[model samples]
Target: MSTPAALRALLDGRWSDLRERTRRQLGVVELPPHGLDRERHREHVLRQLRVLASAGHPSTGFPVRFGGGGDLGGSVVSFEMLGFGDLSLMVKSGVQWGLFGGAVQALGTERHHERYLREIIELDLLGCFAMTESGHGSDVQHLRTTATYDAAAGEFVVHTPEPSARKDYIGNAARDGQVAVVFAQLVTDGGEHGVHALVVPIREPDGSPCAGVSIEDCGEKAGLNGVDNGRLSFDNVRVPREALLDRYGHVAEDGTYSSPVDGANKRFFTMLGTLVRGRISVAGGALSAAKKALTIAVRHGETRRQFTRPGGGEEVPILDYLVHQRRLLPALATTYALHFAQEELVSTLHEVLGGESDVDDRRQRELESRAAGLKAVATWHTTRTIQECREACGGAGYLAENQLPQLKADTDVFTTFEGDNTVLLQLVAKGLLTGYRDHVGDLDALGMARFVATQFVGVVIERTAARPLIERLVGAVSGDDLHDRGWQLKLFEDREEHVLDGLVRRLRAAGDGDAFEVFNDAQDHVLRAARVHVERIVLEAFVAAIDRCPDTEAAELLERVCDLHVLSAIEADAAWFLGHGRLTPARAKSVTGAVNRLCKLLRPHAATLVEAFAVPTEWITAPIAQR
Candidate 1:
């Protein structure tokens, strides 16, 4: 089926020009053949980085004054599109331009930008983001690397006080990086300040380790070998006072630490929040990878004929089977949902980082929480969807030429990095609870009265399992239109609100108890709340995007895609809906049946859906898919 021009335009997302330019750029670039040799892969990625730099691709997000385009969202969208070709190259570019360069731009002042931004953007000086340590990946506040101020010399001496303090799994550290943005505790004569970023030279111009700096390659991993992962330990590494990325906090010449933000924890979190772009970019990249995997797998499913019917002259294509449709179509639908969610995420990121709007603290917190949750979900979705796509293609997918193995292997670490999914979910839950508390705290007399009334109703429902009554009333009014977008959204929203309400009550009841124990017991509940909230966000974003579509054939087709996403999500969580009496057992079964029906409806559009991603034929070079 030919892709509708309208749908094609929609699929280009917010950064249409940038996405098309990148797709064209990727189409023209010559990439190395897929391989297992880490060194070769590393060189291939480095070569691609040079190609990208020459093409001016890495400078999109940087300031135009610093030899960049200064298009934050466009840069990320372009980076995401690169995921279609080589994931290792995508990651390497992200490390160079997003993580390392972004840290400098977001955290540093004019002095640092003037000194390094242009060189970094041009790839003249490769760098590493030395934040994650052996002992602390997410807990930046307690890192053991210390930078002590030398008032006499106007320098800060950076040292890894213990083995665990060594920065580990630092991309570009093993091979290409000449400098690093090292995060360490800032100590002076007065007292120790919390974590601060300092630009320190790790390797000399000739690629040899600088004095007092030791580096070791992290060696082989499950995947992404093209990007050299390494560890660094500092033995009294000293950088000038001006080396500090002091956007948030700064040390005086007299060794007194001062920050616009009064508190240590606040300063640390605010600084770390600047890197939310990394998380958002990773989410977009993961979605792109999943789209590529689905494209290849679905195309193969369409062409690869399997078991012949009895006494039949020809074998039917595997995609004709219900099982195959079930495996690939729902994933395709989810890819759509993730795409829309990622678009919204990128927009929010642009607003925060693009200087287009005022980003207050609350907005920043919202953006961070949403980015963390979406990153977790999108990466986890990519990992699972790629695995399923691989299995759906059977033996053919296991081959490197098909690219599923590469996609699977590369995206596997996405969940662990940025932030661990589990920890991120907890962060989402914490944000939810904090927002809820603030809401209640700010209630006036009229609001408090309304809240009390709502709580009374909630208590009655919980005490009596009143869901059946409400279900009956709704069922009488609407019948079996549960697949309706509004119904689907209400179902998701209700579940999330209910779960949050219950979790909040439980936590409040545990007052004065062991806080850790209380949290430990409620971990599962908290995670469920986070998952439900993220699902709601994804659903709303998908529906909102669909609503914005112009009246065209593509819009009609997208409505079907949106329906599939809603039904599939509902079907996956049928047990929760049934348990809450939001869906009867019969209705729950109908949800699955509806999903199967939507799969059949979407089967014919599978090829078009994937093609709408506009991945170049060269990037998707699997033979079976090509056929």
Candidate 2:
């Protein structure tokens, strides 16, 4: 099960040169020993962050002038690689470099950048992103914290208007942070401007809270104790007007609020959109965690002897069992798929945030929708994959040294943070629906008539022509290759299109009723459409990456991995395919059989696949996995 040197080289080249070097450097760091003492763990992570910062790792995504390489993709790749080690360190680093520092870089004006970017990048000034309030986690618009413009003093008075307005679950707020990028409602004599971000001093350089700012440690959690999560309340905490991170919107010295974007809602959304890189980073980190969990489980399965042969010979490896392959192989395939999807996400993020592309509003919305959907999928997958890996390892996984327990505990919150998975899916669906409406709305009178006619024709063609077309195409290919890339892509695309088309029809049928009620009724259907769309995108990325492989043997092996991923997805939702007539009952049954066969085919490569992750032995300190 040893990976070929050629394949190892190819896998190593998957990330950029900067990321490869960062990964190698991270491997050499001496991590603190694992324990349950939260305070001690927090200190450990803080020390680790300092180490990473000293290594020039945290500055990858910032501007080159600010001691950063200005390499967004490389930064995310490094973050993902770091996840193979201590997740607490990974998260703490993300809070410092990704969320807090990224907020400053992405949202701040040039003056703010010149003043703070270098110091933040160098870890000279620690900060937190103070956005999620006690009453508002996902819903940022309604945050009860207010930043009132004081015209006479030329200051913005930041205050938590109510207890619910307190910034909760804020990383670095408890101990390390000296400043915070606070999101609050902006009020001036002109009007109540929507949510805006301001740089507010949370603590002085002496590690004490600044005047009018009260901080409370959010003691103990399900996991990630190393990250110092805390709550902060502002009691008329006034900051200079220049503290506003006014890339999108700003207030004048005379208390006049203005923005490049006309509407308050648009301005608010534009501001929030700047931080989408955080979502991408989270997804990549979650994928990395899933890979580590699978590596541990698969490696354990490869070596752990479970049952005797029929003739009472030596015990066989657990991986030799069909059930064990079924449990772990598909997950491994999914890890690969997620890896490819995350790469694409990182690239897109770099394009938008690296200032290399002129991304329009439409493109930005599309990016946000995709990031939201993929983050939801990837994090949920991590949670599921880790749980399965834990169970697959049996009792040994429960042991702390095996790392699965800690992996499971730490990744559980990933599903809710960044954005709640459920809410994010809804955002995807909303984006889809809005885009669809806009597309139709853009048509002229004659074009509208033609569009309706075309839609009618499309429906007729779908009902009458699509099935026979697919069947004929399937007939041309060997039944064994039904799980081939072309067919799998078509299957996923068709399923997503079908779900979206149906959702649109259902919404149209609702017809001028209470919009909220209509949306509520279709929420489940909308979520399904979003999930299907994201699955298709992930599958496409996986197939494309496999196609790019130059080594024949490597390509063939990756194709099999892709087969496992696609078939497993098909098998999981077999009932849906069958009910929709997309798959005959016979084909549906074959999907299950195909998945099992692929699992068996891939079992021997399990250890090799995980080894290609190149996790340092120091990072994956799981004893059972080591054996």
Candidate 3:
């Protein structure tokens, strides 16, 4: 009987005040309706980005000394909230602020910050995070674009030498971006350094491409037309040597390159690691999109009646039928679980980054691995969940006005961007096999395979949250009582361990063969290990959140939700459990039964579960949901 508002407060977590304030602000900021022409939508979104800046949406995460709110947690929460409205607006904001502004803050030195952060924050300056290239979306280490130093001229010549090296699908680049944080191979003193970011102007004050910069509109696509995605290429674009965002790697006036870290491999990762916030932000945003989608579907399911009962009573509400409930409720439960997991991720991102103290490399790598895994899992979940939500609401969900079609269209790209989900999960598996001990930046498959063959000692399961509580719960479990929290935690933990151990053995068996080929063949197992590890982390985070809830009423409700989430996860992978002999056939069948029972029990409360998402009412304008 917990009220929606009460559940919302529990779900709001650390930045509750900021979230509420953002919700109100977003309500007042009217969004452009669906079906605007491509240019008009892009123009409206651009205007809206300015409105967000004037309202202080972009300043929360920056340091207060530079005229920002300095609320790291609040900054990310506000970004996440954007998913409640037009996703184009969210991507635009992320481009202007999260990626463009974030790169300036994280990768650039103080001079670059002092010159750029205020303008970037105030919307006077718009920029693109030009990292993804046509050929190198996932692989950042070998970009073909070059920033070679010219010592005599006291400048760096930035050029995109090949078609594949052109910056593609860059937000802000097509229309509004004045500058770009261009990542390119840096060469100085006749020696090539690794990939580095440079602050290069792509457009002039008059809104024309700079003299040496070429821009092309990516054109309207399947979705997100409101964002003016474009491609950028430079032909010997010369800028002052100071253009380099040299916080991690520096080029002196004498054309000497120096870095605090040794080796190009470590230096490349260390530099990329500083910009981890972008990936984490994408995860948060994707989670919110999933929440919005589920809310609509669940609310529609509550009222949209389907076939009548067998005995000829009133038409049954779709949500009450077991088939319908089976479709939506388990997803609803897992969304709740991911909410807690994402909150935990944001908190970790806040503490490890932007601190006055030096960042611990081990901590940073662990954070990166977790962020990668979560981004992979969370966004992929959003893609699947949103699609499922669309289907669950039937024809009504198909209409553009009801919003599921738009949601599905816009979010389809989430799984690939912010690092491809498949590649990211491999990053997680590499960390697991390497035990995250030595230099933490190398995630190349060949490197990982070789490392596993040489250095991987064993599979170790490290607890992520509420260590003592999780340990006690896990240790006390005896039988496969699915409802017992300990047993649930154990299943997740054991699965990850088994997957990791098996993966290590498979890679090591390759001996002196081609490491890359061996790793490539076992890519599915690698992704599975990463996914299994993420699910365990997510479950532990859910358990920890429930323990922290003060209200017995709320905690009890969440307990059932968590149970549904865990059981559904097991049911989805029951084949693996039975094949591993970890779950007897009868026990596996019981999990599906338990999931159905929980869905039935929770059917009456489905509205409350999704409403806890607290998406702004103005945004959830679907008529089916409203009624």
Give TM-scores for every candidate, taking all chains together and pairing residue i with residue i: 0.93, 0.93, 0.97
lDDT by residue (1-627, candidate 3, tens digit) is: 356766888889889999998998897567778779999999899888888888888899988988898877678889999989999999999988888998889888899989999998999888999999999989888879999999999999999999999999999889888999999999998599889999999988899899989999999789899999999999999999989999888988999888888988888787888788888888989889899999999888888887888889899888888998888888888889988998998898889886767888888888899999999889988988988998998888899999989988898888888898899998898788888865765555667777877877777555666999999998999765789999889988999889988888887776666756888889899899999999999999999999998878788889999999999999999999999998999898888889989988899888888878988888988998895
For candidate 2, what is the TM-score? Answer: 0.93
Best by lDDT: 3
lDDT of each: 0.83, 0.81, 0.88
Task: Please tell me which model should have the higher TM-score, number 2 or number 3.
Answer: 3
Model 2 stretches astray by more than 4 angstroms: 1-14, 356-358, 436-481
Evaluate model 1: give its TM-score.
0.93
Compose the digit string of candidate 2's lDDT tens values, residues 152-255.
99999999988989999999999899999999999999989888889999987678889999999999999888889999999999899999999887899999
User: Candidate 2 at 40: error in angstroms?
Assistant: 0.7
Tens digits of lDDT, candidate 1, 34-98: 65498988987898889889988888899989888888888889889888878889998999999
Decide which is better by TM-score, 1 or 3.
3
Clashing pairs in 1: none
- What's the lDDT for residue 467 in model 3? 91
Question: In candidate 3, how many Å is residue 543 off?
Answer: 0.4
Angstrom error at residue 471, model 3: 0.5
